[model samples]
Target chain A: MNRYPEIADRLMGLDEAVSRFVKDGCQLAIGGFTITRNPMAVAYEIVRQRVKDIHLVCHSNGQALDVLVGAGCVRRLEIAYGGNGRYAPTCVRFKKAVQRSEIEFEDYSNYQMSLRFLAGALSIPFIPTKSGLGSDLMNYEGFPPDIRREKKVASKKYAKMQNPFSEQRDEVVLLPALTPDVTILHAQFVGDDGTVRMKGLTFADIEQAKAADAVIVTCEDIVPRSFIRTDPDQNSLPPFFVDAIVKVPYGAHPTACYGFYDYDPKHLNLYRKMAEDDALFREYLDEWVYGVSSWEDYLTKVGMEMILKIKANPVIGYAPGLDRK
Target chain B: MIQYSDNEMMALAAGRFIKDGDIVFAGTGVSILAATAAKRIFAPKAVIFFETGGIDPSLDEIPMAVADLRAMAGTSLNSGLIEAFSIVGHRKLHTVAFLGAAQIDRYGNLNTTCIGDYFKPRTRFSGSGGACDVATFASGVITFMQHEKRRFVEKLDYLTSVGWYKGGNSRKELGLRRGGALAVVTNLGVLRFHEETKEMYLAEYFPGVTIGKIVESTGFPIDTSMAVEADAPTPGELQILREEVDPQRLICQAVLAAPQK
Candidate 1:
């Protein structure tokens, strides 16, 4: 009888997971909306490992996307809007890149982009929606002629066709499926069998996970499968959907994870300031990403006091002393 | 009588457009303040759909971003972007929306896409996130923007969100559902679309602000014949704005109110 030795681990370190799944020029979708539950650890690892020419797909991007853009890791972006909310300055490097035409981008509305993921998840060729009617996005007019022509080669991203079911509307827009090579998500919990249980808004997590060739989940903790099964309704992704599970306690630090911690707005403000200067942004990567060997070391630099300060309070759901600032 | 900054007045004026029981697609900046004030004061049961997919969140503090976890606090349904927008689109969710614009035309079409030629943009802004969807799908839309000649334009450099869509039944002809711009709330006055032509006109003027000033600030000719003095912020509205809606002056700050300052 052939016997397979007991597997040393289904769980791997952050670096090994990133090295294995993320490749240069891959179409990657990182889950979360703006500042909430972003896969920051994985994003930072991708940057530090010097992955290049990534085609990013996101709905509303914020700091994590900006950091990669600042690091010159991204070559193309398919997004709706990218900004650090009002309290922080605009993502300076991203703006500069757009102005310089260093990165080619295609803009879609949030719902339109979400629909693309839904189409990918449902294994459909395309899905129709009225979101982009009369907007320049439907024609890809904002892009330079060459880029626009290149973007149109896919054809299905925005194909205008008559609505067969509707007599009132003559035409509708269809978005192509966006099946990324890999999708990374940061969640609140993952069961032993890799059933993902996400708290707060599950913004595109399940869809992106199911729409990817490989799904990597970085979670706060690995809990018992029985614990997840007890509340089966809350499980967002089943075991078969996840390719890898990484336990990173403060994975979404700086960004907030619902029910776990509050965002460090001050840190984000500091990052916004750093992003304004190209030299300072590189220095930030050095001190924050390369200067630290691992996630534990990064946490050490972030300090337990600051972490505890932003820790979520039970009743209010954000850090107790946060808004007072 | 309490004094109010133009920013606070804008939020208060925008809030006036929200009816009780209307589900508002609330985003960041002044819209959050306006929607929160409306929910707290006029429309207590109104649902707010944050772009984060939180519906009717019970926030302890005013959310800075639509996706902020503060939006998830006490939310009835913490869904995703697809579910929320599809709900609005398919369910006829009886929604209202708040939007901001870099440039707007007489037809109320908004431009947040670019400042110059589309390919060679002079100044590029963050493109429409959910504004286009909400504007197309909502039952009524109210926009908040500073009153500046550059912002109130004769023609947008590029159209990002369609309001009345070249006036008349064109919006409906374009397959838009039964919602379009109802008001444009600026510091100086309130502008509304013409029922027939869909052209914007000065619907109401605020205290100490003249129709001439509004006309001077706008790039296109505006009708002022039927304009009236807008209802001032009530004592209750002002108190809620100052004390509860924005105690930190986050939305009531001078930079937004006094742009030249």
Candidate 2:
């Protein structure tokens, strides 16, 4: 029989092993709508793991994608939902890459994301879809549009007409399926058996897990199976759905954890200033993620005192985990 | 005295009602200029925010476009653009500014999201981002857009964010809390919710702007409040706008970088 704490281990990664677990061609999904995305800090583990050329799917949380994009590990992207600016704009890189024809892009909608997950869960061929079609999205598949036009003739109290600037009927929109290479998510808890826990169901994420060849998770806490069974409904990823889970606290730091606390300010200030100069942006990445030998080293560089100050401050509305305000 | 071009007149009319502190947002294109003017001339202290890009309104240049800035809240003032999202979404500031749609209806609701029905939208523009948050979070919201019949519609297919539907004080009928369109600033004139019925009413007009043109453009009846003024641009405003603010017109994103002060 396995020992009490050792039983919690599905597998263990030492300094070098941790990096190896995050192999290439793995489709990753991270939780977060806007405010509370799981920490890409665990993703830093992927980078430290030397994971390469992987597909990243960010639902709601834009920061996780930014982390991977900044890391230069993303080869192709399948983004269903990204916040306006929660993370750096990969779309720019994706756009530039597309213009150069350097990479592949597959933009998706929330509903379609859910259908894709349903496909993976059901183990189907592809999620036949409907959403985001007809609009420029259809005219320009795989490329983000200046605006998406539909097939309606009437205007509303909020929206007026399209480019015609007149009330004319457009066409129908169909949202296609989204399947990531690997799905990476952040959770409040992952039990001994590997059940993912988050704020909600996140249909898109579920689909990514089902569709992806494999799934990886970055968790805040690793507990006994008994603990997770206490609230099964809150369990997002069952052991059957998830393969690996990394335990890292304050992983979402700059990006923001959900409700427990908000994003770390100095870190955000670091990234905001990066746009002024890419060199500076890359340098910050090196210092923050790449430079550190491990998550522990990253913390040391950021300084334990600073982390305490951040923790000491009242958790802001944006994230740590809960208050959806 | 500052020269009063039709558009400048349009700006001044919108400038009214902007208090010392406001969460003024500047969208894309010329709409940004009107919003900047409002912040520079009227709401200086208002916490300036945006569609997620850099936070402060003090960018030397507007970058290539809105998307170029990403939608993060960080700004040139603090940290870089990318970093600011973490700061703002985390609740660092209290106010934010947003770019409004071309057409607004009787209610102050905006429609950046789509043109038709949700199922089969005619135009699926960038759906409401933090705009919903901005309209709801900011102390007050001021939307800017060009003035034209096409821009001012009878109704928006989607209820992106309730601007001043049923008017500000009277929106209890629709059911909302904290946010309602405060003012709609456009190239031709200004529109606000009626003090009561939540109807679109003329609060002010640009110099040389006629009541007929404004009414003709609007889908709903344009009611008149007080005898509105032209509120021409002040020499100080033009000087700052042309020189200190946007010498290269980068910040203004002006197509024709009008003569510098």
Candidate 2 falls in which docking quality class? incorrect
Instruction: Kindly report which residue stretches of model 1 are placed more than 4 angstroms away from their true locations once superposed.
Output: A1-9, A141-153, A167-169, A323-325, B90-92, B257-261
Question: What TM-score against the true fold does each predicted structure earn?
Answer: 0.94, 0.52
- Across B123-191, the per-residue lDDT of candidate 2 in tens digits comes to 334344344444543445667666667657877665545566545464442323334566777656777
Model 1 C-alpha lDDT per residue in residues B1-261, reported as the tens digit of each score: 668888777778888777777898887777888888888888887888876689888765777777788889888888988878865655556788888778888887887766876665687777787878887777887887788999889878878888998899999888776788889988899999888999998999998899899999998899999899988888888887778877776667644521100
Per-residue lDDT of A272-324 in model 1, one digit per residue for the tens?
77877878988888998878898999999999888888898766667744752
Chain B of candidate 1 vs. true chain B, TM:
0.94
| Candidate 2 lDDT tens digits, A175-223 | 3344454566666677877777764223245555666655666666778
Instruction: Tell me each candidate's i-RMS in Å.
Output: 3.8, 13.7
Best by DockQ: 1
- DockQ scores for all predicted structures: 0.54, 0.05
The total number of steric clashes, by the backbone 3 Å criterion, in model 1 comes to 0
